[model samples]
Target: MKAKGRVLIIDDDAGIRDAAFQVLSREGYEVEMAGTAEEARRLVEEYEFDVILLDLKLPGVEGLELLQEIREEDPQAQVVVITAYGTVQVAVSAMKLGAADFLQKPFNPQELRLAVSRALEKKRLTLENIYLKRALAEKEGQVEFIGQSPAIRRVLEQAEMAAQTDSTVLLTGESGTGKGLLARLIHRMSPRAEGPFVAVDCGTLVPTLFESELFGHVRGAFTGATQHKIGKFELANGGTIFFDEIGNISLDIQAKLLKAVEEKEISPVGSHRLVRVDVRIIAATNKDLREEVRAGRFREDLYFRLHVISIQLPPLRERREDIPLLAEHFLKRYARKHCKPVEALSPEVLEAFLRYPWPGNVRELENTIERLVVFARKPVIGPEDLYFAGFEDQAPDLTLEEDLPLEEVEKRHVLRVLRACGGNKTLAAQKLGIDRKTLREKLKRWGVTP
Candidate 1:
């Protein structure tokens, strides 16, 4: 196989520099040469190198001093010291000064190749470590906890316990319940936090691409699959892979997923070789898997495999006490984000927020707060400033006449929300605090085409 890195050769001897350049170049390295320390320093300023070969003896500035300069310039740069056969002790000192390895004078081609290869590999790993650390720092900030409700505290406690192990976790909740954020929290608290955390949405992935996406595929697996693709599982090896909307995956996909989860190996679509992956699976679904399995749409074995640790997130309506805290937290966050002067929510707006059922949960609450912050004419947000999706003016009144029959009130409220959403049934159902199927049944009974 061809070498896959750049190498810089800094040596005073014409023959040594020429020989090193030729060997490394023929091995597919992009090689360059500098005859003196000054020339090497100039080259270093111009381009990055994976490996540097430095001869200890130079014309003016000695190789050891030049090595110190390189280290001070870029501590992560890989360097291999070159010493004369009589200067074994100097090689040791150079190694102490951060040389990846040492090469003695008059070394054979194999020694040169091996030393360069080792140094290049070391540099690659160092870069990967730096990247992973930066990613962890950045991704850690993506999920933030704002509410102090007991429900959320319980979920976080369970997450802390789950993070201590490598077992699979299943998060069940309504849409916009922040399942994705909780998945991220579990990953950040886990021992494998140093590795990548990949989230895949099963609902968005079509059936034809589901297997290839999760298990990967070799080049030419099918039409348009021109190159080998690394699957989410392989990318998340030694870390975690969160599958969202897990209930939407087909039975065939579930079977393959079960095998990979149970056996810890997945065969690429066209390749016979099964790649081993040590990934922790954290799946989330809004639907109950037990019902899915009973209905024969989901695999029973897979359900058992994933139900090891289940966390059910309570809806925003159930956790009504947290609405004010979450509302203020969102208000402040969105105010700063949008550069708005709004400092607080009006008592009227807060009352409206508390009284209204947040069918869309935290995500919707956040969106509404952002909108209110952007459009606020005063320093405080009020009911008049409050905005709900599909509601052009203010949100609908949170109360209904209690004297009406229950059925009559339910029909009128559902119809009112439906009209507010401009006849969009899904949004209407969410506003009515019911599932789409139940909404459809109500609509059918009312003799509506929708």
Candidate 2:
């Protein structure tokens, strides 16, 4: 069985150390002991412990000084000081140096056990608080799934079933299809809901720091690594780790990540010891891994490892039945967020939205709604508002006439294509048979802001 927690006992007395070790071991904690300050320093550097028991009167070094050093290295360290009778003053000094708690000398087995348990509880709460803050900061307060369409219901069904097991999940969909939101939902439904849910954007990770970002590194591990850093995997221990845009990662990183996903172990960038992590992997990608593997762009083994259970999120156009619901959802959300009085979309506006092909998926729809809400001039958004928001259904007249300049013809055609694409610059560029950068340059020359 896995130990309840790891504990380190640092004391000079042989009998005291043995007694504490046996007591904690009987309670299912992995225990380690250090007789001297030097040995304790080495043990602390090599392993991560949940709680530490320190003797205030070591031979070579003052116990308070050692406590300070430990706390300096790891601000979250939980150390309980052991003081002889009548040495309460010295124990109080240790507390000022960051000791978590102090145990009186001639402590019984129950006292020792209680001190360790309290220290472990404090550490657990501290870590949860830190991870919770990070999780909230990473999100923009978006709700998960909001529609009752068959396409959406099927996805929710699959997700709910997947959440019951610890299997790896691969979420495949077009950009902005709520893959991240679905991942969060699965995490909340899983048994590890109390644990952290860490999301890593594989597409945005710097190649040079990718390994360190996922597995962490010790101090002095690199030129700028001034202090010990925890990685995403370690932070997500006992929870879920969501890798967004997994297809964008290189083959090299795929290879490095394979071992971690397969064995639940990671070796930090500069450490030789492999740390075990209990994380559920949920990877999202806009690309088909099968095609990537056939083209030799992705590793076959890694793809198989991550494809244990696949869930494909339907695009917005495929679930047109849910458009009204989604539009209203975003409308109310952004309306209240931007303090706009907009309450409804006109009939013509809703018709235009249904007729339009949402190439950018739900994300594009959300951005469009937010823009409209921010610039709304009345309680109900009308068809006229769509024109200003760039979702206008009417196409510009482009009849060729004599004496028209070539630049004028090109500009009108580009603008027409831009409007057809719902102001999605990337999609507009593709439709115009040009790169986004070139398209933007042309728009700038034409006195238009892209």
Hey, what RMSD does candidate 2 come out at? 6.4
Report lDDT (CA) for all predictions.
0.79, 0.83
| Tens digit of per-residue lDDT, candidate 2, span 156-226 | 99999999999999999876788989999999899988788899988667988999999888777899998
TM-score of each: 0.65, 0.83
For model 1, which pairs clash? none
Candidate 1, 298-409: lDDT as tens digits = 9999989999999999988778888898888888887888888889988887777786656567876776777778788889766666553333333444675657555565
State candidate 2's TM-score.
0.83
Off by over 4 Å in 2: 58-62, 72-75, 83-89, 267-274, 393-450
